[model samples]
Target: MALTTYSFKDLSGSMSHPTIGSYIFTGEGVGDISISMSTDRSAHDVASDGSIMVSKIAGNNGVVTITAQQTSPIHFWLLDWYNTLWNLPTSEWATTSMLLRNTSTGGSHVITGVSPQKVGDIPYQQQGQRITWALMAADIQHNSK
Candidate 1:
């Protein structure tokens, strides 16, 4: 079994309903895969900004997790989706780097990095209001058997 990373760019959507980002991973056999997300800021900050993380799990197929963080106090939207690739059982897996962009006229969150062992933290000053940002890690694993 082996692991691989895939990425998509400029993804947008609302909270209740989210959109899917696609990627194609070519490999001999599928293994257990875990998915996670990290924005330019910490996951907590992204969540404070009205974003929610949802996992889309699948085996031997493409996986996309939606970040439906709130755009504002009254509205919620998805910034981007990312696949976790470093924690697989295979040590021979490759890392896939992706950069998500804001395609909307308004502000958008972007995700970076592909490590599951790294802790997600807020790296920016709070804008608008000082909301207590909380970080949470969601994991989805798929077994190839």
Candidate 2:
């Protein structure tokens, strides 16, 4: 019913290198949510073809069971110049739903229907390295007592 933003940053050297990011949600009765991402570039060529992997930052044995809704769409883009407009979509785009556990165990439960869709160009920029992803949850019609 309500919308919240969870942000994580990669402190690793360059965009070419892989780094782990983390996010934490601490609210009561949190259920049914969607997630998405936005990039700054319009295409991903040999010069800048990088991928982002989203997962629970905490180990697989923690206390929360985070799930993605079916309608939620994940997206990526590639930009041309700095603040310019010459971008195109990339060939590597996909979406999937899964359940992430926050514990010491190292495993995840993949859910069905929740997947990422390639709707726009795949951008590649060092400044755009900060991936902006969002999640929307299913509507809570009402609460019964």
Candidate 3:
């Protein structure tokens, strides 16, 4: 058998928001999961051994861009959904999988690691298809365990 993998940074074609194990996202049409990451590093230098230690580890600071699109989409309710997800109780954190798994793809991916913050500044744009404004997430995978 061959092992396949998906990336959060993937924003290729029309794709639905990845399933949170089974926690489904309502209203779907060409949804996409686009997120970004940044890292902060510290260096330690000791004269005793003349060695410097550099670190570039996971579970650092990062940002998220969660969005969805519809051909003849709902105009305004997206704002409500975006704001609602942001303020959802900590328990309602959207646990995301690292692999791409949707109705078009296959079953659900089994890696629950992403936790998004409140979606902010939902501004819609129209290109080939009507798309929901890319709402910025507070944080994504800042504490990967």
Indicate which candidate wins on lDDT: 3
For model 2, the superposed segments whose C-alpha errors exceed 4 Å read 1-97, 104-110, 119-121, 126-128, 132-145
10 residues in a row with least lDDT, candidate 2: 10-19
**Taking the candidates one at a time, how many backbone clashes does each contain?**
7, 28, 2
RMSD of each: 20.7, 20.0, 8.2
Candidates sorted by TM-score, best first? 3, 2, 1
TM-score of 3: 0.36
Model 1 lDDT tens row, 60-128: 222233222133331111112212233343431223322223243333332222222322232345653
The per-model lDDT (C-alpha) reads 0.28, 0.24, 0.41
Tens-place lDDT per residue, model 2, 9-55, is 21111111011121233212223333222222233344334664444
Q: Model 3, 46: alpha-carbon shift in Å?
A: 9.8
lDDT-sorted candidate list, best first: 3, 1, 2
TM-score of each: 0.19, 0.20, 0.36
Name model 3 segments beyond 4 Å from true. 1-28, 40-51, 56-61, 70-99, 102-145
User: Residue 34 of candidate 1: its Cα lDDT?
Assistant: 25
Best candidate per TM-score, number? 3
Off by over 4 Å in 1: 1-94, 106-112, 118-145
